[model samples]
Target: MRYFLIPALTAFLAAQTIRVGVDLVSVPVLVLSREGRVVPDLQPADFHLFDNDVPQAFVLDTSVSPLSVAIVVQANQDVRAYLPFIAKIGNAVDALLIGEAGEAAAVVYGDEVTVAKPFESGDLSLALRKLAPDGRNARAIDAGMRAIDLLRARASNHRRVLLYIGQPADHGSESPLDELRDAAETYNVTIHAVALPEIGKTFVSDTFSLQGLSSRSDRGGFKAGTDLGRLIPTVARTAAAAQSADPFSVLAAATGGTQLHFREQKQLEDAVAILGIELHSDYVLSFTPKGTGYHTLRVEVDVPGAKTHARPGYRLTTN
Candidate 1:
C-alpha cells in the first residue's frame, strides 16, 4: 500500500518549520536583484508589510520547510504531442524540487480529474509517464481543486505548492474559477505553472525572455533591480497574451507564483530547474491576522536594488 510523506523526512520537515504555533498567515517572499541573484542576509527589521494598505506588525520567519507539491497536468487529446516530452521529467523533478524531504502528488485532468500518483517520495517522473490523453474537455479548474483538497490534509509543517502544466486556457470545468482561487489562499498553497501554447498556433520565440541572468551582463551594461515594484496585482487579470480568460496566468499571479513557458523538451527541463531554484531561495514571513473576510497583502524590501514578489491576498472565515 502507498503512504504519505516518508518517515525519514519527518525529522527534516520539523527542523525547518520552527515557528510560533498559532493562527499565523505565512507568506513566502522572493527578493531578487536585477543580476538575477537572490538577496541574502536580510533582517526582520528591514522590511514592511501592509494589509489593505494599512501597515501591520509582522515577524520574519526563517523556515525553509520541505515542499508538499501538487502537480496538475492537462491531459486532453489536444496536448497529445507534448506528453512524451513531459513524461520524461520525473527524475529531474525528483532530484530538484522534491529534493530530500519534499513530497509530491500528481493529477491529470481532461474529461475527468484523475489522481495519477498519491503523495510519495520516490521517482516522481513515473507519474508523468503514466499520463495519457483522454477526452476533449480540459477540466483544469476541477483538477486544481482536487490537488488542493489533497494538500489541505497534509501537515502544516510542510510548505504547500501547486504546479500546473497545460495550455493557457481552460475548456470546461464544474467549479468556478473564483472558488479555486479562494481555496488556494484558504489552504496557503503557492501556485506555479509550466504554460504551453495551443496547437496549430504559430508562436514567435523573439519575445520570450528566460528568468535568469541577463545577456547584457557580457556587454558591461548590467543593471541591478531596475523594477523594484514587479509585484502581484490585487486583482487577477482576465486575459493573458492572446488567450481568452487565461486561468493559469490568473492563478499564478494571484498566488505570488510564476508562470513559465515551454515549447520543447529542453525548455521543459530548464523550467523545472528554474522552479527549484526559486522555491529554495525564498523568504517566508508570518503574521497573526486580526479579522476575517478577504485580506490584501503588500510587501516592501528595505534593501537597495531589491525587487519583491509575494501573494497579493488571502481569505479567512472564523468557525
Candidate 2:
C-alpha cells in the first residue's frame, strides 16, 4: 500500500506542473471584417503577428474547446426601460451554454454579480430572471471591472468573452480606468459591448435630473428641481461626453475586442448570434517574445483582394 500511494502522489504532482511545448500556447485571434462580419476562411499563413515590433512565429489551433464568459448587465434605470433587450440576451444565453461542458457564464447586476449557469444546457431562464431586477444604485464601470477580475482568476486555454450589456458609467468604482485596462490586457479578455440605443430623450432627461437631485435635498425638492432645470444643458453635455468616451468601447479596443452599437431591438439577437459563431470560428495563434517586459503585439491578415479588421495590438506577458 505504501509503495502504491507513493507512485500515485508523484504522478499527481507531475500532472499539476505539466507544460506544453512551444507549439501549444492557445491565444485566439478573432478576425472581423470592416462590415462587422467574421472572416472564417482565413488561414494561418494569411496572418502576421508581431511582438514588441519584433516578428514572432505562431500556429493556428482550430480545435474546439470550452469557453468561459462573463456577462455584465447594467441594471440602472436606463437599462430597466430596455427590458425586452435584456430578455433577448436571455435567448443568446440559451444558444451558447446549453450543451457545452465546463463552460461557465455569469450575469452581473448592480452591486451584485451572480453565476446564472455554469456551462450546462438546461434551466438558464432562472439566471435570466435573476438579471431582471433593476438595482437603483448599480454602477456600470464597477460592474465591468468586477467581471474582468472574475474571468482573470478563471483563466483557461479556451476563449474568454466579457460581454457588457449596456452603456458605460464610472460611478462608485474604486479601481481606476487605467488599472482595469491593465488587468484586461494581462488576461487577454476580449470585450463585446452592446450599446442599447437611446430609449427616448425624456427618459434621458428625467434620469439625469433625478441623479443630480439625489446628491442634495435639504433645501427642498422644488428648489432641487429648479436647479436641475438650470443645469440641464450641462447635464446633457456631461452625458454626451460620457457616451463619446465609452468605457466599454475603450476596454473592448484595448483588449482586441469589437464594440457594436444597435438602435433597433431585434439587432441584439443578431449581435449575440454573431458572437457565438465567432467564438467557435477564430484561429488561435501563439508565440514567445524576444524580451521579458510588456510587449505590444499586432495581428494582421493578408487576404488578397480583401479588407480585414483585427486587433490593433496586445500587451504580451513577459515575466
Candidate 3:
C-alpha cells in the first residue's frame, strides 16, 4: 500500500505543469585568439561551452532585437592622451544604434557616472561634448563600477554591451572579488576592456635616475652594481598586476566579453567597430532549464566546416 501511494503521488506531480517565472535569455560571445590576432571564419561547432565546469547545449538564431549599450569612458590623464580614440568609439556606437529605432546608448564619464542619450531624438554629439574628462583628482574605478551598476539596472530583456575605455583601478572599492563576481553573475553583464597605451615609462625613468647614485655608492662605487634590469622587471610586474586586477577583465571574462589593448587611436576605433559588428551579426537563443534552481547554459553554432567564436557558458536563474 505504501509503494502504490508513493507512485501515485509522483505521477500526479509529474502530470501537473508548473509555470516558471520570467525566463530571460542572452547569449554573449567573446572573440579571442591565443596569439591576440582575430580568428575568422569560425563556426559554432569549433567552440565548446561550459557552466560551473558542466556542459549544456548550444543554439544560434540570427534576428534583430533591441539592445542596450553602455559606453564607460575612463578619462584619467592616461586616457586623456587617447581622446581621439574615445571619440571614434562614440561615433561607431552612435552609428550602430541610430539605425535601429528602439536601440539605446548611454555615455558616462568618470566625473559624471550616469547620463542618458536620447536614442530616439537626442544627438549623440552633444552628449559626447557633455562628457567632461576626469578631474585631476577623480577616481576611475569607482566611477566605472557606478556606471556598470546603472547600466545593468536599465537593461531589461535586451542584450547589453558594456565598453570600458581606460585603465581599471580598484583603489577605493570595498567589495571583495567574490562579491564583485556575484554581482556580475546576477546581472549577466558582459565587460569588454580597452587598455590604453602604457604611460609608466616617464615615471620609471625618473625613479631609475633617482636611485642610480644610491645603488652605485653602496656597491663599492661600481656602476654595474645598480642593475636596472632587476628593478625594471619588478616594476613592470607590479604595474601589470595592479592594472590587470582592475575589474575590467574580471567582469569581461565572467560575462564572455573580449578585452582589447590599443597602441593607437585607429586601433581603438577599429576595435569598437568590430565589437558593434559582432553584436549585430551574432544570433540569439532561448531555452528553459531542464531542472529548477540555477542552471548553466552553453551556446555553439553548427557551421560544419568553419571555426566559431562563442561564449563558454552562462548562468540561468531558474524557477
Q: How do all models score by TM-score?
A: 0.82, 0.68, 0.62
Best by lDDT: 1
User: Residues 1-319, candidate 2, lDDT per residue (tens digit)?
Assistant: 0122223222322222111123233355655333223344456788887766677787665544556677777665656766655655564444432123324455555555455554434345556555565556556666667777677666465456688777555455566776677767666677767666544432221211111111122211111122322211110122343235567656765665655555545455545543454444456676654544455566667744333333444454554
**Any runs in candidate 1 off by more than 4 Å, and if so which?**
1-22, 120-123, 200-244
Candidate 1, residue 89: Cα displacement in angstroms equals 0.6
Summarize candidate 3's per-residue lDDT along 197-313 as a digit string, tens digits.
444631111011111112222221111113323211110123343235557656655555656656665555545544544454344444344443344445443433222344434
Please list the Cα RMSD from the true structure of every candidate, rounded to 1 decimal place: 6.7, 17.6, 19.5
TM-score-better candidate, 1 vs 2: 1
Ranking by TM-score: 1, 2, 3
Reference-based lDDT, each prediction:
0.72, 0.51, 0.46
| Colliding residue pairs in candidate 2 | 98-121, 103-119
Q: Tens digits of per-residue lDDT for model 1 on 1-319?
A: 0112223223322343323223688878867664545565578887888888888888787755678889899888989999998888887666557766678999999998998888844346777887889999999999999999999888777788999988867788989988988899888888988888887775422122223333433321112223312222222333452143778777887788877777887767766665665676567788888789889888887866666778887888785
In model 3, the runs with Cα more than 4 Å from the true position are: 1-22, 29-59, 105-122, 136-141, 153-155, 174-178, 201-246, 290-297, 300-307, 315-319
**True lDDT of residue 4, candidate 1:** 29
